[model samples]
Target: QKDGTKERYVYACTPDGTVGRCNKISIRCSEVDEEAWKYVKELMKDQNKVEERLAEIEKKLTSNPVDVTPIDNQIAEIERQQRNCAKAMVTAKDDEYMSQLFQQEAHELAKARREAEKLRADVLRGMDDFQLVRSKLDEFRKRWLDHKTKLEEEPTYTDKRLACSILGLKATLYSAGHLPRYKFTITPPEIEFLILLHRAERQPRPWCVSVPAG
Candidate 1:
């Protein structure tokens, strides 16, 4: 307490060095931290769920491993045929109809080659996304499970901050009347998966104290 009034602690938006200042966007740290911990605790307790999610992600990745060998072979054969057609066209240059036939064959082969290349790219992209989600989930599991004991009992400020960082927690403060209102957002599982797939940057660790959560 400060002069009989309770001291206030908050998370405020950082301001730019010059004229760019935040419009006093801040949330009471305790409120946001408690809410964030509730969600983290729920997730931590559900080991079965976390394992299931990991299994699901692994199944997707393993069942559809990214192998572009077949596509590459297909493209190779198409290009070979295209080269043969070119040779045939040169030899049959006097025969306009035969040359046209070779030209048509070349066009078809080119189209098939393009399609094969596109399929390869698509396969690679899909597998990359799957791998990305799997990696993030693996990291989340490792980080949280490593601190299982501490989490089960009482998490320290550092533990809670770590959880909030991993979970992508966000708190926004606003004023409606004379009182301040705060909104909190926890990253949803599906959206988190998408975010990982899109290669979103990792969240920075929040400023925290070492004291246990009250």
Candidate 2:
């Protein structure tokens, strides 16, 4: 079958994506696969995406991009809502009504401030989680690539699954290998899990990797 003979092979691409290739051959020696060109082409398509990303990076380079504008927006909305409360106070013309109005407005402002602060904290936490996830995904990708490379050196091996797994792109791998069986493949519910996880109040002292023995 090596001498220009055709053979059938199934390729599981993305989740719910598939392709079949027969008698594929390469005439040139290459550093990366032909498919890698597609990735490069994808990156080349949009100048706007590049410029937008640059702007986002510049925003991050500034000191503390998070601003009080969200809080300001909430304050404005609350003030509008409390106008009726203010009018009520004016009509009553009693010290008790004035005190009540002040307390109500104070509570509304406090609630808005708290909500904005919580959202800001959540965004910060999400950025940290993204970094952690990228690191972990990189580790997985490296290991998957190494394993796939070893497999390639053998007499027979298909790189279909390996390429996808290398870059955190293996959802279809599970689907192909008897979908009903491995259907429950894991996905990162990072935000949901992080919400449940409470940070330890006390900082744990750093421990040396090895303990010196007497």
Candidate 3:
């Protein structure tokens, strides 16, 4: 509204208030706006130019150019050294010093071979001794197992003998009227009674006669 020029107005509200002020805007383009637009266009063009240059640089970097001339030269030098070494070997084939060196190496190899053979023999002897010991141990184990089996069976044999002796003593004592009439088939309790009777008879004044006249 200033200077009698009609200007467009816009309302803007801020976070600080519910009511906002009407701001005047220019509807006609000004020379400063044109200059600002020109500046923005120029800045966009420069940015685009920078991006194009960066793309060109990236393409060059991705091409991976390499120079192998130094490596080729090193390979050529190595081949030359190998050829020279071959020529030297051919020239030195019949040298007397080389012959002596070869003979000394052969003698050392033979000495080392003899030592290896001696060590192999020692290892073989040790293996043989170990095998022999293993066999003897096996035999001892068999004997010990047999003795253990006999020991395991010994109680049964001893029990049979003890039962026979008890039966025989019971028969004799019953026949002589020193004990009660016995059943033909003796049980464990009868055997125990016979054992007690025998133990008591071994005392003074033979208790067999005083056993209730049974």
Candidate 4:
């Protein structure tokens, strides 16, 4: 509802006939009032801008492979420094001053290893960000497709039934451990399986297989 308007909007109605108020709702542009249409147009423009930015991010991700050569070289160099420090320690077995020098070199090698590990962690985080963005884009695209279909099509009884079935299956998957239940240390094969499962869940009529009656 607008601040100065007398119009009241009902957003959700429960099975018990209870109505609820909502802050905002998505409506077709043609259905919006003139004052509201202005804001809707602005929102559409903003959505387009966001889509453009996502596309640019995706392009960069696809075109520029993450170069891990620097991290690899850093780790390799640190390893070499540690090996040299070990040799120095072996050579300075008797002299106290030489032993102190070797110990200092060993400390420096440890510091280098720490720095290299931090760099490797930073690179991994960058890769994770890219993957997270891509996953969000895929989810958004799926939701947009569903919304468009609902708005554009005059769904028949069969269509509605199919949609209900899909929703039910999605709910079941959520209840079960099939859908994204929790973040854990999973193998690459498990990750691939989850991706395939999610894709299957998103399909309109995914339950083609027969389930035996218990």
RMSD of each: 10.3, 18.7, 57.2, 18.1
The best candidate in terms of lDDT: 1
Cα lDDT of candidate 3 equals 0.35
Q: What lDDT is reached at residue 201 by model 2?
A: 8
Pairs with steric clashes in candidate 4: none
| Clashing residue pair totals per candidate (backbone < 3 A) | 0, 0, 0, 0
lDDT of 2 by residue, 1-214 (tens): 2322223232222222222222221112121223333342343245464335334433433433445567567767767766765676676666886778776776776687578778767767755654543443344335433343332232211222222222222121122223221111222223333222212102111110111122
Stronger candidate by TM-score (2 vs 4): 4
Better of 3 and 4 by lDDT: 4
Worst 10 residues of 1 by lDDT: 205-214
lDDT, candidate 1, at 154? 70
Give me the overall lDDT of model 1.
0.60
Model 1 agreement with the true structure over 1-214: per-residue lDDT tens digits: 3123223366554554222325455556676667667766777687786566556645655676577888888888888888888899899999999988988988888889888988999888777777676666666666676555656577445445445554555555554342435555654335334444235333322332221112
Error of 4 at 155 (Å): 18
The segments of candidate 2 whose C-alpha lies over 4 angstroms from its true place after superposition are: 1-94, 146-214
Model 3 lDDT per residue over 1-214, tens place? 3233233231122223223332211112242223323332343344454344334433433353344455455555545654555565566679978756655655655565466556656556544544443343343334323243332232322222222332222111132243332222222223233334333332211111111123
In model 3, what lDDT does residue 140 have? 30
The collision pairs in model 3 are: none
> Where does the lowest 10-residue lDDT sum fall in candidate 3?
204-213
Q: Write the per-residue lDDT of candidate 4 for residues 11-78, one digit (tens) a residue.
A: 22122322332322222212222323233233334556545644654675676467778889989998
